[model samples]
Target: MAVTRWIAVAASVLSLGTLFVAPPDAPMKKTDAFLDAETTGVLGIEATECFDDPAYSRMANDRVVIYRPCEESADNQAFGFVYAPDGAFDRPAVAALGWDRCGAAFGKLWRGGSAEGLDFYPVLPTAETWADGDRALMCVVYRPGGKLPGSVLPLAN
Candidate 1:
């Protein structure tokens, strides 16, 4: 009878442990360092504007750290902030930095692995040459149907 009781106790413990298991479907979130809004936004027009503007003839020592919100790897400083106008002209230019570029403004990651997130960054651009990591300011980032992150977590897991 003692042996039977021990077996029953063992089974109860095992069953209880299953409660802590991860759910079948859940969203994942991560945190990392990114550029502050003030500098990145200011440099958009002040540093990259036409040469005639006074904002273009200033110092190049500002610290900018725009992190493409949708990138898997955020270890790029060399790709830093490249400035450009926020108009129709810069739309393709900003896209040239790639969908994963940090200065993508309010762009978010897509939930589906095969789709691109919306780009909500706003441009105050009247410039051509931007300082590294500098781009126009974006207002907001929203997922389609209100259901996704800036970059969808890769489905490889």
Candidate 2:
């Protein structure tokens, strides 16, 4: 789906689920780290450390992990999650589900009026990764031509 359309759908579904932002002291999951590493490799962005701003702690669901780069100059925030399906695994189906899930959650924050200028998109599991049983999807949020100052969670508050 187009980014704008997905955002619209996501805004409608924001209130559908409970949202949780990971506490600063919480341990980072290996999956979260893996997503971070993979994203760096895939996007070719140089990030030496995790973003640790107290105001912008990581966010997670039971399966998804959203992270950001530490560099104050970075342009976007990223979310990674395993997209396992109950039945046969189809690429399009998996992508759609992952996309919507990210959209809904992020949409919640955006609809709350906290995420005014940011945009988001998902990077889905490639065929090679899927063959190896990796179903991770990374959702990235960003503001065009700008840097984020803090967490969207708090902005909503």
Candidate 3:
């Protein structure tokens, strides 16, 4: 409870906090706002299953904490998806491409009623559109600790 003891404790906490405490290890993707904004412009999100890599668990009943698949669409009919741990919102879309969060475009996507998220490709890769469209899509939720693939783009907000 002395001054020096308190200072040491605070310093220790800070050191541990920065060194030890960190964001949960989750699969991430990137979307470059300047280059790949079309695929990264997520306007909506839809919840799917919550499961580990190569498997999934149905969390349909849990509304408080649902797994939302980031539904993205940009100009020229581009579509993409990003996974959300909690609820869905446009702010989350911004968060997905923001500097703090993943800051990358999500990979592995569910097209219509497909089984895999990485099955689809950029709809209009050669098109020229600054904004994005409004389309419902599902993105691949990569396994924790897995690095982004070569195809996935970085999100720059």
Candidate 4:
């Protein structure tokens, strides 16, 4: 299947009866090093490879994103970083801000390509980290159903 078409199908399948509401405050885990070496100290860098949930083993919070080499086999890929707007660490509000930033970044990178099979989400800061002054939000893209063989980044000129 064409990459775009495949992405659409994968997104639809993954979204079937599934909701990704943020966990309640009581259950959310505190974390440090939300972005790994590969993801940190850089901005607008494309994923050189792909990653999955297992690659995120370093951090327990799903909102914390760590980059693993594609050769290592992982579920999601770090597309870029978005700094969270200054505010209280309200999960929904932060998420909305993150998504808006990510959307703009994605558009700049993808140039209006079909976002079907692709899933873009934010790795946000927990209240504890927020209080500790963690404001960097990791924006990632992945295929919900399986692995992506290579970087999903648009080819550079």
lDDT of 4 at 141: 71
Instruction: Indicate the residue-level lDDT of 47 in model 2.
Output: 25
Q: What is the lDDT for 22 in model 3?
A: 69
lDDT value, candidate 1, whole model: 0.36
Candidate 3 residues lying further than 4 Å off, grouped into runs, are 23-27, 30-55, 59-157
CA RMSD of all predictions: 14.0, 19.3, 17.6, 14.4
After TM-score superposition, the amount by which residue 65's alpha carbon in candidate 2 deviates from its true location, in angstroms, is 17
Per-residue lDDT of model 2, residues 1-157, tens digit only: 6999999888867755435544445322222223432332444432222232123224521233233554454445554443566555676787677668877867765675566666665556656666766666766565653555543333324
Best by lDDT: 4
Q: Rate the local accuracy (lDDT) of all candidates.
A: 0.36, 0.51, 0.32, 0.62
Sorted on TM-score, best first, the list reads 4, 2, 1, 3
Off by over 4 Å in 4: 1-50, 54-67, 71-73, 112-116
RMSD of 1: 14.0
Ten-residue segment with the worst summed lDDT in candidate 1? 47-56
lDDT at residue 54 of model 1 (Cα atoms): 17
> Model 2 segments beyond 4 Å from truth?
1-71, 80-82, 86-89, 150-157
lDDT (Cα, tens digit) per residue for candidate 4, span 90-146: 877777887798879877776655555666666677677788887877777766556
Model 1 off-target regions past 4 Å?
Answer: 22-25, 28-113, 116-135, 138-157
